[model samples]
Target: MMTAERHFLADDVPDRVRVGVADLAVATGETRVTTSGLGSCVGVAVADPESGVAGLAHVMLPDATGDDRGKPAKSVEAGVERLLAELEAAGGDPERAEAKLAGGSKMFDFSGVSEGVGERNVERTRTALGERDVPIVAEDVGGDYGRSVELIPETWTLTVTSTHKGAEEL
Candidate 1:
């Protein structure tokens, strides 16, 4: 893991390909992409099993609209697009991609709020993926907590971890 929140003292732990907040990455087999501190943020993982390629995105918002300020993965819409493009560039077929989603947790409570940012993130991600004709095969989303995630392309698994909840593979 490559985040300020967690560190491993053991040399046995595998080194990760870290995708920070508002970032995204595409990798082939034997590499895992990870992100931490998912509060009202989403981790979108896409895999092309036959091609042995995968992509992970740590999206912080719904849409970038006019400008992303140079951070392409800051929004779900742009993140999904960039992830697909990156994956395709790495020899992954976008037409054969399958998506898995994690995070999108409501870390804070606000009185009388109609909707949470977490929910919006999930919705936007679904919409973006759907528009691209990509199917979401798995999801772990929506709650009042924070989460960290790792996408292992070798296994086509997304390991979602939350302090309040135990870790699970999606």
Candidate 2:
């Protein structure tokens, strides 16, 4: 029988909640939310500092063709909308909310695939946020490598980490 290894966080590292691909997470207070290995996928984060409410979404596609069967986090359009709604429900004011976006890396080079999925995801994400009147204050997008993102609701800071480029606060 094989037993799974248990990974424990360091003492200094804050508790982290992971938002997987095609998923979203919202948190308040000191809890931090994270999403990893974003290649063609995009991570959209929104936060309201006053309320200490933050939300993160890992969107895998630009838009949903039909229906996600109630799962909105799978597409950039629905995912961002869902995140914003959750943030507002958590006492975050829409007017005071700000956004940070990362990932959208062009991981492949197909001959005739005009406009890669990464670029499309970024564009659609921007449009969705714009429609909701959420201002995007920072972004780390359009590259050739994957990314990992973490959101700290307490400080309303988003830390983006990339294997090739290290980490930076957005």
Candidate 3:
């Protein structure tokens, strides 16, 4: 539920706006937004390069249909809704939006509560974005490690970084 302190980046430089687990952030101008420590949680990033508007959400669960006990970004459905709204508020056009997703790794394998959580998170993310008519241009999901993501809206780039996979930009 926290957005990083605004940084005045000159032309989408490397200055980052960091978000935490189950948190969401929106940037209007030139800046990179990032989030970390994603294991079995999804990082959803969306952007409109034309407006230099973008948003990021760290989602931990598949759904929050009737649950309101925590931040909206803690769940896939609400997080997508909120993130899109925030981007539009920041002058992003939904019709021109594209998405990049990363992180949904099964970092642990406990029999009690760790089955398919990552898969479900990714599924819900796709479904939510589909409903909003936002196309997923690229993705780096499903694995056995952790990931962190950074989004630079001016170039509409989403960078996925992990200890195991180095770094990739989408």
Q: How well does each candidate superpose onto the true structure, as a TM-score?
A: 0.86, 0.87, 0.88
Per-residue lDDT tens digits of candidate 1, residues 1-170? Answer: 23212222223334567888877877766676788888889999998889777878889888676776666688888889888888887778999999999888877777554348788999999999999999999998988888898887778989999888889988
What clash pairs does model 2 have? Answer: none
> What is the lDDT for 132 in model 3?
88
Q: Give the TM-score of candidate 2.
A: 0.87
Deviation from native of the Cα of residue 78 in model 2, angstroms: 0.5
- Summed backbone clashes in each candidate are 0, 0, 0
Best by lDDT: 3
RMSD of 1: 5.7
RMSD of each: 5.7, 6.2, 3.0
Poorest 10 consecutive residues of model 1 by lDDT?
1-10
Residue 84, candidate 1: Cα error in Å is: 0.3
Q: Which residue runs does candidate 3 get wrong by more than 4 Å?
A: 1-14, 65-67
| Tens digit of per-residue lDDT, candidate 2, span 23-48 | 88777766788899899899999988
